[model samples]
Target: MCGSGQLAVLLVLLLCALRDVAPLPDSGMLFPRESPSREVKELTGLWDFRADLSPSRDLGFQKAWYKSRLAETGPVIDMPVPASYNDITQDPMLRDFIGWVWYEREVVVPARWVADEGTRVVLRVGSAHYYSVVWVNGVKVTEHNGGHLPFEAEIGDLPQVHMMAADGRAAYEDVYTLPVGIRTVKVTSTQFLINNKPFYFHGVNKHEDSDIRGKGFDWPLIVKDFNLLKWLGANSFRTSHYPYAEEILQMCDRHGIVVIDECPGVGIKDIRSFRNASLAHHLVVMDELVRRDKNHPSVVMWSVANEPASEMPPAGLYFKTLITHTKTLDPTRPVTYVTCSNYARDKGAPYVDVLSVNSYFSWYHDPGHLELIPIQLNTQFENWYGKYQKPIIQSEYGADAVPGLHSDPPVMFTEEYQKLVLQGYHSVFDQKRKEYVIGELIWNFADFMTAQGVVRVVGNKKGIFSRQRQPKAGAFILKERYWRLANETGRLPPWTKYSCLL
Candidate 1:
């Protein structure tokens, strides 16, 4: 295995090769097709709970009381997978525990699951809230930082097939697997690795809150969110500003979406939070995240900061060190930071495996100057390409929408505006595919609530879906474009049957 020093060397080599190297992979690499032969393990179920920081939380996830309490809980508390605490807790104290949560569930590996040596089971988290450490049947499988990014843990070593002991007791009492199955199995962090290659993350930023739910979400509702993005042709997703539920990540893994696991580090614009933020605290948060979701196969990158432009020098150094530390903890995937600096060349852009930039060009600038926006974007990409030689993913790019306002030929800001901007973006994207630019994810999948209050009708209606799960005209425009771009098949999948907006 490559050590930390080796990884650092690799990063340096990337920097050294920037100016002259051609692009790595073809931009035409389509969204990965589903694997019919693979069987996924579902870890969704009731989790035993306690919030007072009791010692029992540390007894590990296998304690009898914990299991019994979780199983016996009524209504199963309706804690949806791929959701957040914001959806569950109404208590003041519980509401702010955004960085920590203990999740427990019982899973039985079917007797036929490990029939083949190459088959494996994975426990994946779409996005962790802030920090998390995941344990499977008491085995520490994976952990991750970054609440918005996806992460997973490998449960291959865990028995895939289970049955009652010879005494016919608990269904999980005994486990069996082919001896060769162990060779392909592992217990590790879910750093992103697609087709055994490090895939650059490309997708939109997401928020957990909907104006309707006010932070509440159920499984069916959550699946709607996925369908909205999937049909729009997004292969990757970023849980902007906070950790999302594991339910989302599990779906992403099964559905073949790359995830950028993010931390709840946004909104640090205030000086007080910046000063109070400690590397140790951030490390603790990130450590938990890395521990819990590292085994997921869909998570491709770990993002530590977003829009830290205000703290340029110090924040830049902080991000570099954090990325370095992340590689130390788990080096399978890449590290990145989304910069709001608008400059084609960001201060810390060189440190990441992929360069991510957020630009409002045509949206905030001149919508009439649509042609010029892509040019400006390309110029910026060129500057970074000249310096980093790393794959570039337009992390954030989209205009705000009011829903139901699209024009046929497409106009800017109207439902047509999304289609217009996408048209411009794809125009440039196609041109640069040969230069190694990967792909683009529209800024958001759904309109969501933000504390910013800068919104007009509601807070940040950039999503293709309105805050109430209503499909906007932009959703349709985006869906057509996304499908054309990714070459996806038929209607929304099983998880997204209720909402076909994508």
Candidate 2:
């Protein structure tokens, strides 16, 4: 019924409305999974690598290195993919390199994937160093600036094929190669639940540390750690202070392990450090962490900071903003920050969904007085419950134990002392299990390297296992307690009494 110009104007208005209503592109990291129209190929293997040692150098993308033209620029060396370039070679320079290292590889997309219009091609890197930039066949695809989590690029169309030989000795040849997926993690007033069922975190706090790799993505070490966790009757773990390699999360997903993915916002003390610059970096880290690990079923919660200065008045606003932002990223999982602050008066306690506390009652507080653990823990838990009325997790609690030390009556650094310390915490944990206390993750799973200090022998000795991944005397004590707790907490079915031991 309208005139031509009026009709055209109406079309313009409709189009503008549609544009405003359209959903935004997903900014989250992608993990390849085989759907009806999707396929994946891992681009992990040998990659040409070099580290820039110049005091000043421009960005790699600004130099247009993603064009796969590094061979034309300077010298190149072969290095393994999914690895940190720091400790791969005998050269001390390469082992201690801290600057921008470049890695490049030739990849070929599958013809079948290119043929399907609905199919999407993505290149996924499990983990890299502090920063990484990727180019797919001379086209800049993605750049991620975090070392711990995975980053992916959606390569829409496969370019003309010109693949190099596998041994890195020849020219180009066309070959088909290409790439590459939550349970509901709910929290009630009294319990943590997965799919509406009560869940308990019988786990340890872990770091991606080892003898040689030094935070590098090592598959064998990952397998060993998971095996050790299973052997210890652990069903969960916190990525203690930073995001772990994606391969670790994938294995946890497949093995039915719960994860509390944490950020590297440790040692954030004082109001000056909690200002805009620090908070901005913290938010960026949170964005990357959520985007990368959002889809993993193993991840039940996101830990924003580890042992932050929560007693500071400014910390209240800092954590509140960060926690609120994390919730916006993924509203499904609970957001919490690990605090060593007193429950009766932590400035950050009101900001988190779960009250995560790191208590060292007997070890640090009363110093070898195991008798005070239960009483102290009980009072703290009661205070936290009364104040917050939220679920609580003993995010960290442990004692330092040297591997071979032994004392019958229990002395500090002795194996018997570690066992007794755990027994004391377990006694209190059992009593609080009936209430709102949902989890207790031991301070660490394995002994790890740390900055040298007067109090530290070699490193923090709180791990149930030694640095070599060998179990200490405390390991058996935890194994027994965890198995029993899992059974009593209904985490395992009646027929699965000793399944973790299997």
Candidate 3:
């Protein structure tokens, strides 16, 4: 062993995702050094506070104090946050009032943050007692009950969870019900069979992210995405990188859209994170995820992690235990983990029921070499299937295409380049899909917010759809390709002949 064994830099997603890849444009800075993708802002200081003192105790709501300055509505006392108002104030009425006590703090947001639409501003409340609601410029952003643990809200739009409860009792009996589709999913060495027929994973990887709302769920966005999916004839999707909202899975169940439910196991890069304690926590998350999602028939597989550092020695044991625990929880479904590691070195490859791999031949590996994709992609599939003898999924593949970007001869980050990348991958898939490859999920369903960087224009531009759900040129390409898939393979929707949704 070395005398001190100290390292200067951390290598994340190292060796695994980065084989034969181009070098970084710049060197790494030391720890705590700021980069384009990192940011921090604190909201702590003075606020104006006033308790509802009128007899009815609803003065703030009635007068709409959130509309304007709380000081203008009534007499306000200076207050400091990070301390409870009841404990800080001297007046007994202010201390004992069992009503709305409004606290307003005026903080200026830099114009640069607003001008750069890709920048995401989040408001984190350290602690708010009992209940709280927040507003800015008369637009409600968030509300919460219980405190101590930090809570955050995106500044653009209202959270949909704050919707008023509807009285369903008037329309129906107390026993709530939904239509359930009964189906079966089976996996063998080279195929995924749904209801006794071969099935292909022709779908997208989705995130519940959008412009303005961020991760805030909105009904309009939800319905529109579903419509878009239908129009593309997409039969399935992976709840990529992490689980989506429960309502999304329910919609999948209703509309015959299949799902590969994944947990929040993306970027398990730090080798130290594969310790026993971390593995135990990972198991607990799997338990909760399976318990929540086992009822949905649309869920064909359980993907425990995405693009983990499986080449690390500890990964074999970690993924083995994880996949075994998941199968014990729900033996009806096959379990797998997504890997971006090379087949020869990926330690976790042998244990999963299906071999799911992600690679960008022309994109991440050999940038600007579109001709490299067919040979490289075909070799990738061959090597994986030869070693594992398990059905393989091209879990993720796509190029970043900035919306409205065009190039006459195809160039990276342009719409035409993205189209060429897909065509290259498809050429390989057309050769292997019927033989051994069972699925192909595009890198993203839509563009999503990411930590900003030079390569990312505000966010990852890998989606076929823009962040606003508008169709990019690639969308039309997928639309045509998927429709052809539907025509050739009628069982793409598993429930194509049945009216399973009520």
Question: Which candidate tops lDDT?
Answer: 2
Candidate 1 has an lDDT of 0.56
Every model's TM-score:
0.60, 0.77, 0.66
- Per-candidate Cα RMSD to the true structure, in Å, reads 14.2, 11.5, 18.8
User: Which residues of candidate 1, in runs, are more than 4 Å off?
Assistant: 1-193, 196-203, 270-277, 342-345, 366-368, 406-412, 452-454, 487-502
lDDT of 3 by residue, 152-239 (tens): 5566332321212223222222232445678988888989999989998788989877765455446688999988888787999998
For model 2, give the 10-residue run with minimal summed lDDT.
Answer: 8-17
What C-alpha lDDT do the candidate models reach, one value each?
A: 0.56, 0.74, 0.73
Tens digits of lDDT, candidate 1, 1-502: 3332221000000001012122121111111123444444444445445432334433323443222334342223344443444436666555444222444444445544333344454555544444455555444555543334445555655532333223332223223321110001111122223554333334567776764345444666778777666666666788675556656666777776777888766665554444424555566556656765576666767777777653345655666767788888778767777777745435566567776677777877675567777788788778766766766767788888777675666666577776667667767776775466665767777787654454445467778777777877656766666556554323223335445453
Candidate 3's TM-score: 0.66
Q: For residue 187, what is the lDDT in candidate 2?
A: 82
User: CA shift at 342, candidate 3, in angstroms?
Assistant: 1.3
